[model samples]
Target: MSGVKMNNVIKQYGEIQVIHGIDLQIKDGEFCVFVGPSGCGKSTLLRMVAGLEETTSGQMTIGTRDVTTMDPSERGVAMVFQTYALYPHMTVKENMGFGLKMNGHPKSAIEAKVAEASGILKLDEYLDRKPAALSGGQRQRVSIGRAIVRGPEVFLFDEPLSNLDAELRVEMRVEIARLHKEIGATMIYVTHDQVEAMTLADKIVVLRLGRIEQVGSPLDLYRDPDNKFVAGFIGSPAMNFLDATSGEDGVTIQALKMTAPNPIGKTSKAVTAGLRPEHLEIDPAGDALRVDLVETLGGVSFAYLVSDTGEKIVIEERGDEPVSEGQRVGLKFDAKRLYLFDAETEQRLRA
Candidate 1:
């Protein structure tokens, strides 16, 4: 296994520079995930690491070897793309062992490696089946198995779960996590799905507009984001932003008619208060909020409300009786759980 490192890396397509200078590190055997919205350059950065895209400037290294200019085969990395890229005429065994065969490995050695990968991915039952006969999940597993047979030092996944169905995506996430745990290889996965990043990543690298917003453990990013963008992008239903202004004693939220203590020192600048959906509670005597809609997902519910100031907020509901649509209700904000950001800069105001 080998760690990957980039020092002020930049990528450009003639005059259009899609990737700005980026510096990052992935520890050996770490399951690192790159997550961001579409056109955020996460895939471009991943492709750069895989040697599929060239680095316009700066340095990149795999382990102790500089691979910025090296060929894809020399980078010691195996990539599993979004597509399965399986051959319809080839059986699972053949597909898995094809790479090794092309690389001129002995037939017996190829068989041994294929057997090992198949065992790891539970593809032994489907080895004799062709790609047309396998399910989407199984075909994806075959694709992953093909990468495993190469025994590369680093594994790169570019939205490998994007093609799978919801259920299959969940299953594949578990399987990939298990595979990482069992093999202990350095792996970098790229996906726009925050859930996947939160579930599978040992370290999550949140990117925005070709620049890294923040890099930390999943919970660290979720609970302690550096800015509004990071905070909003890291969580489901996202963190709610409320218009507020700094006051002498505390920050006053006009929308909720609440004042949360300013943990940071007093500031004259306008502020935006962030509250996660789970942190807000329904209170009969609190600020009145009109429910626009309610989404009940079994154990938990989400109440979409329009505050008095016309700001939209989502509150997670856990009670047996959920707040209904078009209902007027009061909301209580947990001052301790509140997040404060500078309205102009959108940067967190830390205590």
Candidate 2:
């Protein structure tokens, strides 16, 4: 296992700059995820680390070796791509050990490595089966097993679960998590899915428009984001934002027709107040919210509402009975849970 370091890494196509002076460090044996929306340069950055994309400028290191200009095969990194590129003609065992065989590894060594990888992935039963005979999840496992047999210093996964169905994605997530724990390898994963980032990452690098927005543990970014974008992107259903005018004691939200205490003390400026879906509660005496829709997902429900200001909000509800559309329900939240951001800068207002 090895750590990765990027010092002022920059990538450009002709005169158009995409990645701009990115600096980051991934520790050895850490499960670090690069998460962002499409065209955010997450995949481009990962490709640079894998030696597949040439770094336009800056230095990159895998462990202590400078691999900025190294060949892909000499970078000591194994990449598992979104597509399962297993050979249809080869059996699972042969597919997993193909790299070793191509590299002139002895037949006995290839068999031993394949066996070890299959044991770790629980693919011993399917070793004799070809890629055509395996399910989607099984084929992906074979792809991962192929990477494991190489014993590279770092593992790079570029949306490895995008091809699987929703249920199989969850199952494969558990499998990958278990594999990381058991192997304790340094893994770098890239995905646009925040749910996958929150669940599978030890540390998440949130990127926007080729620059890093934030990097921290999933819960830290969710609970204490540095900006409104990070707050909105880190959580499910996203954080609700409403325009407010700062007052001496607090801010007045015209939409909810309520005054919330301004803990940050930055008054006299236009601000935006944010509330997570799970934080809002339905209270009879609180500000009125007109329910527009309700989504019931088994035990928990989400009530979509529009406040008087025409701002949309979603509130998580838990109970047998849920608020229906057209119902006017009062909404309340803890003062501590409310997030205040500068309307112009979109940065969090701190006390």
Candidate 3:
């Protein structure tokens, strides 16, 4: 129901610092996701917002309230963690209404709120069942229902689907997305999975080594990444980086055995060329790169390749074309689609 803001927030434990100063804003009724690899401090950052982790320095506010030092119970935020954390002996209805009951709400008020949340989360049929009887997806929905019953100012989910199987993860993603749409509350979710971030986020904050890497809409980060890390981390098959150098006329990609018309020409700086797997095609006529492996995931097939220089490349096979392992091939792609990055800094080289 309210926006969240962090201004120069830092988290440190004695001598070591985990979260470097981070400043970010999540708009009201927005679904914001924090995504990064393990130990990138994504979870630490999420916990700071939830008041689960103490803020060593800086300020955090939910709506107009500065909750930097606020306790979890006082923060006006409800969190759904990776674990369900449900009471095994309590029925789904009791589990959902327990918080309200403890707060001294009348039985009628508790029942009404529990009923409302159950309807929203499609948990009505499981109301009488205990945690032992519910499926993983159903139990997780009950966990979410508990959060919904409180009607907090914001919702926090810390990789709520990590414990589920792939199919259940997909189902819960839809459930969570729908919950957000129905409630229209400010929500912050944390995950190491880029696919979830791409699918569910209105705004994504990419982090690395306790520092914020970049923030933008899912498509914006995928189409125009600020650095090699963002470009690689946002996509499924990921963007391929190859050894390249700039010369008199253009940039030469050693792995592709081709020179592209440089957007910024005539530089002697060494660079890395990035090509998305979807933008390239395997050329059977040329023998510069060899096909190492092909992975076919039904409609989409990926060809893993290695060049004479031993650089690896991954290309999504167009038209689901057949490619054999050990077949020597060449790579073809739009010259304009090529992305250049500084070799040392790994930063994008824009024209």
Q: Which stretches of candidate 3 lie over 4 Å from their true place?
A: none
Candidate 3 lDDT, 23-126, residue by residue in tens: 99999999999999999999999999999999999999999999999999999999998999999999999999999999899999999999999999888889
User: What tens digits encode model 1's per-residue C-alpha lDDT throughout 43-73?
Assistant: 9999999999999999999999999999999
* Candidate 2 segments exceeding 4 Å error: none
| lDDT measured at residue 85 in model 1 versus the true structure, 0 to 100 | 95
What TM-scores do the predictions have? 0.98, 0.98, 0.98
lDDT of 2 by residue, 133-227 (tens): 99999999999999999999999999999999999999999999999999999999999999999999999999999999999999999999999
**Model 1, which residues run further than 4 Å from truth?**
none
Spell out the clash pairs found in candidate 2.
none
Model 1: how large is the Cα RMSD against the reference? Answer: 1.0
Least lDDT summed over 10 consecutive residues: which range in candidate 3?
A: 315-324
Q: lDDT of all the models against the reference?
A: 0.93, 0.94, 0.93
User: Cα lDDT of model 1 overall?
Assistant: 0.93
